[model samples]
Target: MTVAVTLLLASLVVGLATGLLFRVWALALASPLVAVVSAIALQSAGFEFFAGVSVIVGCLVVSQLAYLLATFHLHREKHSMEDEVDGLPGKHRQKNIRDQYE
Candidate 1:
């Protein structure tokens, strides 16, 4: 029970930290953090830390890959829309509207 809760908390923290890091650094950092946390969890649980670390690293890799994939997909969609619209069409027209409150 304690192990399960710890693992859950660790995973959330790792995910959030990695996500923030991804915004600035590179996504690859998540794997190492996941591995280290997994090792600690395994040690506390009386299991082989290496194997647990490997599994956690795999999951982190998958998560980062998914994040990258989704980001690219969203970016592409945004650009496609931008290409269709070109830019704001009536900027000068809107600017010409006189303010009545002078």
Candidate 2:
């Protein structure tokens, strides 16, 4: 694979791991930094403009998607655990504030 593609994938994987394994907002910011560094490296390595841009965009998109999915999974797990702890027969717990209000 090209350097651009390799960097993009690497950045994405790191971003996903950050989002999934850590809940800290500051830690999640590393993905964008990685993307920027990869894009710069690609440009320095004589990559075409389109290739560099593609890698940058791909990195951002993948990182966002990973973050969203990870957060969603974490939230779902949290709510499920809460429900289990409630142990209310014939009753279900609401997962969010909106649900509780409604």
> Of the candidates shown, which would achieve the greatest TM-score relative to the real structure?
2
Query: Measured by TM-score, how close is model 2 to the native structure?
Result: 0.61
lDDT of each: 0.57, 0.70
Question: Model 1, 53-85: lDDT tens per residue?
Answer: 555665565556555655565566345543457
Q: Candidate 1 at residue 62, lDDT?
A: 59
Q: Model 2, residue 56: what's the lDDT?
A: 81
Residues 1-102 of candidate 2 have per-residue lDDT tens digits of 377677767766776677788875844477668777887888788879887788788877776677677777777745565456655422343345447688
**For candidate 2, what is the lDDT?**
0.70
Angstrom error at residue 65, model 2? 0.9
lDDT of 1 at 3: 60
Candidate 1 Cα deviation (angstroms), residue 9: 8.8
The TM-score of predicted model 1 comes to 0.44
Lowest-lDDT window of 10 residues in candidate 2? 88-97
In Å, residue 79's CA in model 1 sits off its true spot by: 5.6
Error of 1 at 61 (Å): 2.1
